[model samples]
Target: MSWQAIAKKDLQDSIRSRTLWATIGIFLALILLLSWLFTDGSGEGTFIAAAGFTFLIGVLFFIPMAGLLLSVKSIVRERNTGTINLLLSLPHTRGEMIVGKFVGRSVVMVVTVLAGFLPALLYIFVQVDEAGFTQLLTFLFALSVFGVMWVGIGIGLSALVNSETQATITGVVMFAVLILWPLIFEQAGIELPSFAQRFWLFVIFADLFFLPGRIADGDFTFPSVVEFDEVLLEELNDVAISVGPHLQMWFVVVLVAFWIILPIGIGYYRFSTTDL
Candidate 1:
């Protein structure tokens, strides 16, 4: 109940913040602009083109940025300004405070994601066939989860650090590690050890941006982005086979769960043990 109260307050604060509206405005503008560019005089392939474009630009970049922007400061700001002490002075425990902040900020991030993708969803429903509509829904669901994943990471970092600058820098570095490092390694033909390769595979699988292509290709293979050498592909396949049981849909869910929960759990521990 205390967490609920805290969550309500965070949601209200987000609603009042200009940053929220500004993000929504910019997201909508991007979605609309992409939709316009993808649309022809006739509506052929409009939805597909727009949706793919959105997933590439919107999901890959904008959603992560927004989630981090809204949440990376959630706990540290309160602590730095001595407001966390004020909050704890109420009926709230540290656990409730963290849960409430996560829930509230997660809601803001999810809502922003929906607002960003709604135009594409509408375009798909209006101009595309039923199959495309189904794909659009699936894409939206994946994007929403991806957005929440970043929010959890941001909240965790917020709670983990002592200051906004620390949180911001850590958030950026973490993002780059999870996103950029894998990309650079793959592009440069650099080979990681088996375990590291699997971790990167897990990251790409969790992002699920390739879901549409997977569906279209009718190839349900994990890490479907690989177009590398046959030997490397065979090696990766061997690794996947070694971890076969863990590569199931359930394992994917578990991986995602860890991404969202592990950081928050660690952050809560740190927050609880550290003095305000």
Candidate 2:
């Protein structure tokens, strides 16, 4: 069998997972409920507003949780349970297994992101006056990339570890670094150089939440924290502007490429050399 066959099998397995379905169900329900609770009834630019709310909740909570849940144990579980031997008995190499698992799990995450954002799309399409389809599509594409990045981290962590426990601990640490560090930095008022702050924000997918309305409206701005105190938001804007070309949108490509490639590459390296 080839890596394609492994990817197909993994996809089928993920589709059958009750936990995956449950995560999707909860994400969809919460996004809709939050949209209802948070959406202003003024009906002016409601689509972007509602989508902003959904994206915030997803970025802060659901997307990371689901990504970790679906991928963090992928390779380690197979190794621990002796399925790795059976898989190797096939014609595929170990590299194919790692690639297949990452691709398969990444597909699962994309589907989860799509399902989670369907409610936001409902609001977007309903507000056709200001709801630029291009904007929504752009933000959704960015959101998918963010979610897939987490899947890569989880899969990489799984492959690097030898046990389920190690995977779990590493997953928690990864989540904290990716999801909580920015919040800590913002809340504690920690000082960093402007360029470093912008780079770190993008690293944690903060820019995706920070610019949802701009992204949904197709008017790009330097992304900053807009959900918090007005004064802090202004400060962030100033810093964002002062950083100039150091933190361009193209830098997002560089960071995403680094994150997606480094973890998987490291994990593949470890997996390739380790005795299975």
Candidate 3:
């Protein structure tokens, strides 16, 4: 079959599955419920921030789940069912098959994100009058990049692992890294003298790895209420030392390039060499 045909079939199969749609539904419901509970009737500062935070949390959960569920079986299921051999026996190249699967799964992820988030955008515009529309758009754009990176990581793991169980576990661990790292950093009190400098450097390197420049930049903001004065300057200095003005854009670009290129290259390499 042609590559287009393969891609189309994969897309069709994904759409027919309930997993993506159900996940999107859950995300939307959670966002709406949180907004209702936390947002004031007038929808002002705290409410808007709450809405933004809620959506951010939802995206974090949804992206990895979507990536893992959509991609974990792309190749392994075929092998389990003895279809991988038949597909390899065809005239199609391994590269085309791998690309087709990635494109298909990535499309599913993009569609699900839009489905879950677009209505939230509309609601914020109509109901919550506090946040600017541009802010929501900017946040969503950053989130889409985050989702895409997770999807790439999931596909890469799926390609490398031989068993479905192993692939599922790998995907879950990767998902945990994507979701839990920030929380861990927050709880560890990176502002402490011993941890401050190292933490800032680690944060920059993570931003370079994750391609989320806005998140890294936002991390530099001082808390609204500070209890300790002595460590504040030192902490801010460490953050400043971690990411310089000139390097921010370059770091984001390089990270994004690597995020896009490395996974597909590695996945294709693994798929090409593996015995089908």
Candidate 4:
């Protein structure tokens, strides 16, 4: 069969898998639980905002992690279990195989996201006005983009690593680094020089999941994103001034797209060239 067929088979397999179903069930349960916990008894603006924020925080972080976990062993597991060899024996190129793996995992991720959140989204749309519905759409878009990026990341790691164990560790370590590096650097009092601040900011931007939390609080400025002193700002001023007013809207999206593509691009290069 072709790569599309392979992806379809994998998606069907995941649907039949008990673990996948259980994860989806638990995710749905969490949304229901958080919805009740955050919603006010009065069911007014307070309830809507609280419930929206609650689900946003829960889903934004959880989806990437779930996608990463689902994809962690996409290729490596097949390799470890000798299935990669079997797959290669079929009429498929290595590129087709890895691409199929990514597509399969991404379908699973998007399905998981929609299944978990669509119920709440529907409720929000029914209860809230047009502006709130627009905001919710924005939230969903961000979550989906972020989820796709992690799928690529997981597939990339799967292609690069030699074993399932290595892929697992690599995915977890990458997640931890993205989540904790900024806090760790700040807590350690390790101040980067002025010239390096913009580059550092760029590294931080690579973690798109970071933006949802900040966006939830209605803080969308650079200072809201990462802390910077006068010196660092002065150093990074050239970088910021270059982008100017255009930086606020679509610039963030380009960064997200970059993170999404870079890993898979690099990993596909490695996967295609290497013997499976």
Candidate 5:
């Protein structure tokens, strides 16, 4: 079969599946609820920052879950249904098959993000005067990169594993590792003897997860104690700046490129070698 046919079939299967829509729905609901609770009617600059940051966290969790769910069965399910053999017998190369699957599923993820997040963003813009268009745009760009990486990782894991359960578990474990690794390292409290050492450490950790360490760095400014009122709607300005250590932008870009390419290369290698 042609690559176009393969892509069409995969896209149809995804649309017929309700799990994809369900996951996106849940994410949208969470974002709306959080916005209602945290956002004040005021149009302060900090309000935009808070909403954008909260939305970023929500998308981080949502994108990985969606990627894992959509991709965990891309190949294993075909094998289970005895369709893999027929597909492998086609004139298309293994690389074509793998690439077609990735493209099809990645398209689904992109649509999901646009559908679920775009309207929510519009609502925020209309309802909250504090919403900054620039910040929102930046958050969306970051989220797109994050989503693509997770989808690539999921496709790679699915291609490598034989069983659907194994693929699902592997995807979940990898997601957890990527998401939590930075926090784990930070909590471990490695003694940084010098500024150079600290900078390199940030770069190393950030590269592993494909996230800029600057985003994760905690507030460097003093005035450690934050009042309780600041935590509630009564005071939104009490949030402290958690910024100090940061990875260079170039380092993040390189890491993102590695995340997308390396897994896909391995998937192609495995697909090429596997017996039809």
Candidate 6:
């Protein structure tokens, strides 16, 4: 009830700060720059999937960073400046305020991503007509869901941290680890003996953060690498990790659902009970 009022006010503050416009500008520039590279008709043979996938990759990198930037200092700034007390003196309770901040910030992030993504979508429709409507829509949906998840994470981190610097450092480090962990894990046991290398293969299958990137690109099958002997033209069959129906797109939906709920849920619990 009172949450709606707080949420509206939050939206207004973000709008007045022009953060929304700045986010849109970042997306627009990314779309244009990547689109040019993707559609340049170079001899490298860039197809519809390639262009769209590349664009999705950009969305994966930029939108989450934007969400983190928007939210890392959200609550702490208010608290530090004594404005949070003023907000509390209004009609809303702590729970309402927590819910309002999350919802309002999430909406802003979603709208900002959509606005920036549309031009790229339109360009893809024109430059890569073969990409098709359904696939594009699917990619868009995945990107939107991914962005919302990060926004929720940022909001929760904002509520949980004591200072903007801590939230920002944590967010940046987490993002870096999430993006680079697979690369690190890949090289981890390379120098080990075959026995240890075989075990490391199992560790590679535990990649959770990279799955959303697969969803965004519409490539859902689990990664399986096969080594071949070029001179002999022979294939060596190795052990394959067995994955069930649990690895489907619905699995990604579940992951996104957990991300969206868990952070805000914990933040709400803490903020609701913490002294104002």
Best candidate per lDDT, number?
2
lDDT of 5 by residue, 1-276 (tens): 566777788899889888988977887887777665555545444535555555656655777788777776787778777787888787877777777787788888877777767766666676666656665665555666667777777877777777888887888898787776656666898544322232232233223332332344652221111211232533456554342333233345555566767777887678678764
Q: For model 6, state the Cα shift of residue 189 in Å.
A: 3.6
- The models' CA-based lDDT, in order, is 0.74, 0.75, 0.63, 0.67, 0.64, 0.65
Q: What lDDT tens digits, residue by residue, belong to model 2 across residues 164-219?
A: 99999999998888766667887899866545554453443655534554554674
| Order of quality (TM-score) | 2, 1, 4, 6, 5, 3
Could you give candidate 4's per-residue lDDT for residues 1-276 as a string of tens digits? Answer: 578977997898788987777777877778766665555333556424754576665544677678788887888888888977878898988878878888888888888877877676666555434435545656566566667768888888888888888998899898777566656877999975433332232333332434555567775554322333432775777554232322332245556566667778788888788776
- Cα lDDT tens digits, model 6, 112-197, are 77787767766766775355565556556656666677788887877877777888798898677655655676678544332222
Show where candidate 2 strays beyond 4 Å: 127-129, 183-190, 198-246
Cand. 1 Cα-lDDT: 0.74
Model 6 regions more than 4 Å off? 41-48, 190-245
Give residue 52's error in model 1 in angstroms: 1.8
Which 10-residue span in candidate 1 carries the lowest summed lDDT?
241-250
Candidate 4 regions with alpha-carbon error over 4 angstroms = 46-48, 123-131, 190-246
User: What's the lDDT of the predicted structure labeled candidate 6?
Assistant: 0.65
lDDT of 1 by residue, 194-222 (tens): 43543552354433545555556675544
List TM-score per model, in order: 0.80, 0.81, 0.73, 0.74, 0.74, 0.74
CA deviation > 4 Å runs, candidate 1:
46-49, 129-131, 192-243
The lDDT ranking, best first, is: 2, 1, 4, 6, 5, 3
lDDT of 3 by residue, 1-276 (tens): 556666787899878888777877887787666556555556665324755566655655665577678777787777788877877687778777777777777777777777777776666656665666556666566556656666676677777788889888877886776556656766987544322322232232334333333454665322211212333765877643333432333345445556656866787788789886
Q: Which ten residues in a row have the lowest lDDT in candidate 3?
A: 221-230
At residue 261, give the lDDT of candidate 1: 93
Let me know the TM-score candidate 2 reaches against the reference structure: 0.81
